[model samples]
Target: MRILLWHVHAAWTTAFLQGPHTYLVPVTAERGPYGRGRAQTYDWPASCVELTPAELAGADVDLVVLQRPEEWALAARWLRRIPGRDVPVVYVEHNTPRRDVPDSPHPMADRDDVTLVHVSHFNDLFWNAGGTRTVVIEHGICPPAAEYTGELDRVGVAINEPLRRWRVTGTDLLPRFCEVAGLDVFGIGAGRLRGLLPPGTGLYDDPPQHELHRQLARRRVYLHPMRWTSLGLSLLEAMMIGIPVVALATTEAVEAVPPQSGVLSTRVDTLVEAVRWLIKDPETATEVGSRGQAAVRARYGLDRFLAAWERLFKEVAPCMSTPSTAR
Candidate 1:
């Protein structure tokens, strides 16, 4: 099947494109948000091809997977075709509610033209996607090489634009966790809080996915303190990398992380204690991390994710082949 989607979430897109389909991503002369083409920093498959707006105008796309609200207008202008009207479409909502809970109106609300896909069930329950058909396809990871060493005693956390999204990303709480052990933070704008962060904090800019996983695997424990947002991909990656996780039981996280995997609680103190314990007992950390590794692989395998997506695609776009996951 030929699928057209904007290059928005690179990590999500990278895993999505691994499916057995031709993925056409828009590319401009000067790559920006709308047209990042292919990931330069991360390795992606050749099947995920880059096509200009002009080329896409004549391209045969079975379905247009829309991520952003503006992409609907952009698709119509670029493809000279209306999304969901002239072409089948699936709008994927990656984040949680922006304004208020159960009251925040989705941008594509009250639409029957396209199927709204929520990455997590928690997001589907919260967002009011009126009139639009909604489905839950929990996140899945294309496993990176098993690299968890637990050799480093520092705590690892990944966040983007930490200062700007301080509260949402739980950036202000970094100091609290710093007292447990040294911290190695990775993501966009992570280095901005060098002065404000505690002495144990070490910041790194956005690194490639492989490197991110490799570095994160070295940490004794992975910290996920996001207070408001959808389930982060980093947490899942850390689990897949066999890193013992210590996350706040918020949003979809409550459902995602089981007790046996690591330690998840609403109390930050409990989380800090768990991390300190993991640091002290590397063997116990590895045992707990192994449970998370097994659980994540069983639940969020690439094949399962792609199969679920294929089932959804078959529903909206009749031209697609039978989905093995579909009943």
Candidate 2:
């Protein structure tokens, strides 16, 4: 099947493109937000092809997977096909509600023409679907090959635009964590935190996914400080890399991190203490990390993620089928 999707979330898209299907990604000469084309830092299969707006005008795509709200209009303009009407469409809700807590109505609410897919149960419950068809497809990823060494006594965190999304991404909480252990931050706008962060904390600005995993595994424990998000792929990647996790017990972090696997709490002091203990006792950290790794593999494996997507695609376009694995 030919799938039309934008390169919105890199880690998620990377895993999504691994299946046996041709992925048509929109590309603009500017390579801006809408048309970033394929990922340059991370590796992707040849099956993921890039098409300019002019090229997409003539392409016959089997399904349209919408990420952002604006993509609905872009698809109609570029492909000359109205989503949900001209082509089967599935809108992926990748974020937690930013407006009202539990009262926030989803943008696609009450829409029978499109199906809304949530990445976490927390989002599914919080976002009032209001009669909109919805399903939760929780996050999954292809685990990196790196193993946790925990040689460094520092904490590792991965979040994009931490400066802009300060409180939301828990950038305000970083200083408190830094009081316990130095933090090595990785993501876009991470470098902006330099000089602003406490001394000894390191900043890496959007490194490649493989490099990020490799760096994260070296830290004694992975810190997920995000106050609200669907489920950070980086947190899952850290667990998959066998790193002990210390996360705030908010959003999906509670479900993602089992008690034996890591420490989760709403109190910052409790999380700080947990990180301090994990850094001091390397043996305990290793054991906890191993448990988290096993749990993540069982629940969020790449094969499971892709298979669920395949099922959804089949349901959306029954006539379409996975092509040969030639790519």
Candidate 3:
């Protein structure tokens, strides 16, 4: 089936491209200021089209998949202009708590044509979108089998930015936690948040995805101190590579990481203690990492995710007119 996916988020793009179908992507003229530049774009084996807004308006598109709520207006316009009013529009929610926008209560939330797809089950439960048709589609990972057996001394933390003061990502909590744990933390963000890094922790400017994965594999433990939001793709990727995660017991992390895999706590002292415990006991950490890797492969692999999407698309797509129905 022909699908038009307009997802600015690179990870979403990567996931959709893995499916077997025609895909259309909208390219932006501007580069992303935060994070590494967009993931390299390549023509997929399936019929693929890359278009600008003007080109998209004139093209014969089928389904339009939007990744952000802010893009609803543009998507709505496209839907209206499409030849048949039966075209389905899907919204992929990548964030949690849904507080990025003021709680204005969008009218589109009540529309049957618009379907909301959350990246995590936690997000689907927490977000306030007023009775919209919602589905949970967790992020998928393509993990390498070759494990990193090198010396693993460092602890890694990956984020697009050093947590902003007002944002709920728990940036301020990291420095204090690092002070007590003495774990080396590295992250990606604008240099503007320089002083935000804990005293002796190392910081690497945003690196490419493969490079970042390599760097993460070198670290013995991955620390996810996010106070709010759904489980991040990076956290899942680390687990896929057999790295135990020390994260807060919030959102999807509670569901993603089992008790044997890692420690989950809400208190700062508990978080610090978990990091130290993992650091002191390498064997235990390794075992937990192994369990995590197995779990990720069984549940969050690309094949399972693609299958789920296929079922979803088949169910959601409008019924084509058969010869009998047309008559």
Candidate 4:
């Protein structure tokens, strides 16, 4: 099947592209938000073909995958087709409620043509999708090689715009984690994390996805202190790479990380203690990290994600022969 989607969320889009469908991403010279095309920082496959908005106007898209609400209008204008009615549609709910908690109205609320897919169950519960058909397809990742060498006595964190997001990304909590061990932060605008860090904190800007994983796996522990937001792919990737995690007991983090995987709690002291322990006891950390690796491989595997997506596509769109890679 040929699917049309804007490259709104890189990590999620990267994982979604692992499925067996040809994905069409909009490309622009400026490489703006809705037109990020193929990821340069993260490796993506050839199936994720980047075409210009002009070219996409005539593309034979089987299904349309909508992430941002604005994409609905863009899709109609670019593809010359109404997303849900003319083309089968799936609106992926990436983030939890930001405004009214239980009362915030979803952009796709009460829509019958589009199926609303939530990344986590927590998002599904909190979001009021009105009468739109919704489904919870938990995040999945293609596990990187399990290289859990906790030689570096540091806690690694992955966040984007930490300085801008501040407490929301749990930037305030970094001081607490820094008390136990040296800290290394990686992600977009991470270099801007200057002055926000404690004495031992190190700010490293986002590297290529693979390099980031390699550096993060070397750390003794991974810290996920996000107070609000959807589940971070960083945490999942850390677990997939067999890094013991210390995350706040918020949102899906509580359920995603098993007890053996790592420590999940709201108590700052408790998580700080867990980070301290994981850094000191390399053997125990390795054991717990291995448990997390296994759990992620089983629960958040690529095959399962692809299957769920394929099922949804089959339900709404007819099976057409795969498109040729040639332009």
Candidate 5:
């Protein structure tokens, strides 16, 4: 099947290329994380083709897959003009939107032709959109074999966007924890901290995935302070490397990590205590890390994720071929 995947977010392209099928991606004018538009191109597989929006207009595409809700208007317009206009469209929600709006203003929430896929089961339960075909597909990680040999004094934190007054990410809590625990934090969005964080905290505007993984493996513990959202990819990468994680017990995190892997608590005192405990007891920390690794391998491996996607594709394909009764 000829599939057209629309990924506004750069990371989704990495995962989309894993399937053994012909995939088409839209080339964007905006530069990505690594560098200038020339420096950071997507690492697409041999089976995939990158096309311009104008080229896509004339191509014979089967399915238009969207990774975020904001892209619904664009997909809707594309669906209306494509030859097989009734082709199946899928929307994958990577994070829960700000649902606290007076009334949920999500346009595709009630869309009949669009199927919603969530990255976490917890997200599916929390997001209330009636009459929508919703499925939970958890994020997967590449398993690690060798144990990490990095120093334990460093703690790694990653955030794509800084927390504004409207959105909260637990970044506010990091400085306080770092000060109390005497740990060095390497992170993105350091500007968000401005005068809050002490000296010597490593900050980067952007880093490649391979480099990010390398840095994360060196850290003794991975600290996630995200107050509202589904499980972040950074947390999974740390767990896969057998690095213990200390995060807030909110959103999908409570369901993603086990008690043995690390401590999950909302209390500041509890988090502070957990950080200290993990730092002092290397053996216990390693044990927790091992459990996290095992959990990720068993539950969120790539093979399992691809198999689920294959099954979903098969189920939706026939629906696309059938004519709707509305017409």
Candidate 6:
């Protein structure tokens, strides 16, 4: 299959591109948001190729995967073909609705043209998709080769644009965890948190995937402070790296973190206490983390993720033929 998609979510796209498909990512001279081509921070497969808008017009794209609403119009303009009408289309909703909480209607709600794919059941429940077809495909990742050392007693967190997302990302709640142990934050815009956080908190801005995984494993416990989000891939990555997690009992965190694997609670104090205990008790932390690693590996295996996508693709475009180059 030949899939047309933008380089929107690098981590998710990296996993998706691992399947037996030829992925077409748009690239511009400026390398803007919509045209990032292949991922530089994370490794993607060779099957993922970059093409300009003009080049794509001639490329026979078999399927279109939309991430944002604006991409609907962009697809029509760039390919000169309307999605759903001209080619099979799937919109992967990566974020939870920001407005009106549970009552907020999804931006793509009631749109019969495109099928909506949610990353978590929490997102599926909160979003009012109306009559639009919807399905939940939980996050999956290739487990990192690095094993957890937990030599550092610091807490590790990964979030993008934390200052701007603030409360939504649980950035404001970071200070509470900092008191328990030093923190090491890794992500885009993380460098800005240097002076703002306490003396112990260390900030690493947009480190490459290999470095990020290495740094995360050194921390005693992984902290997820997101108040609202479609389940974060970083959380899954941490678990896969054999790091015990402390996250709020909200959204998909409730489901992702299995029993005896990690601690989850609505109360910030409980989570703080859990981290404090986990930091002090390395033996218990290792045990818990191992359980998490086992559970996540079974639930979100790359094979399972790719198979689900394959089933969906077949349903959407049963008649579409596979290219010779596609796996």
Q: What is the C-alpha lDDT of each candidate?
A: 0.89, 0.91, 0.67, 0.87, 0.68, 0.91
The true-versus-predicted C-alpha distance at residue 297 of model 3, in Å, is 1.7
TM-score of model number 4: 0.96
Residues 273-313, candidate 3, lDDT per residue (tens digit)? 77777777788888888898888888788877877777677
Give the per-residue lDDT of model 2 (tens digit) for 155-246: 99999999999999999999998887888999999999988898888999999988998899899999999998889999899999999999
Badly placed stretches (over 4 Å) of model 1 are: 321-327
Clashing pairs in 1: none
**Tens-place lDDT digits, model 1, residues 37-94:** 9988677888889999999989988899999999999999989998888899999999
The positional error of residue 280 in candidate 3, measured at the CA in angstroms, is 2.3
Location of the lowest summed lDDT over 10 successive residues in candidate 5? 31-40
TM-score of each: 0.96, 0.98, 0.84, 0.96, 0.85, 0.97
Show the colliding residue pairs in model 5. Answer: none
Model 6 lDDT tens row, 6-51: 9999899888988878889999999998888888998888889999
lDDT of 4 by residue, 1-327 (tens): 788988877888888888767899999999999888998887788889999999999999999988899999999999998887888888999898889998888999998988999999999989999999999899979777548798898899999999899878998888877878999999999888787677657888878888888899899999999999889988999999999999999998888898778889999999999999989999999999999988888899887887787667777785655433322
Candidate closest to the true structure, highest TM-score:
2
Candidate 3 clashes between residue pairs 3 or more apart in a chain or in different chains: none
> In candidate 5, what are the lDDT values of residues 58-115, reduced to their tens digit?
7777777776554555545543463224567777777765766334434457767777
Which stretches of candidate 4 lie above 4 Å from their native place?
319-327
Angstrom error of the Cα, residue 293, model 2: value is 0.4
Superposed on all Cα atoms, the candidates' RMSDs to the truth, in angstroms, are: 2.1, 1.3, 5.1, 2.4, 5.4, 1.6
Assess the local accuracy of residue 217 in candidate 4 as a C-alpha lDDT between 0 and 100. 88
Q: Which stretches of candidate 3 lie over 4 Å from their true place?
A: 31-49, 76-86, 98-108, 144-146, 165-167, 180-190, 318-327
Say which prediction, candidate 4 or candidate 6, comes out ahead on TM-score: 6
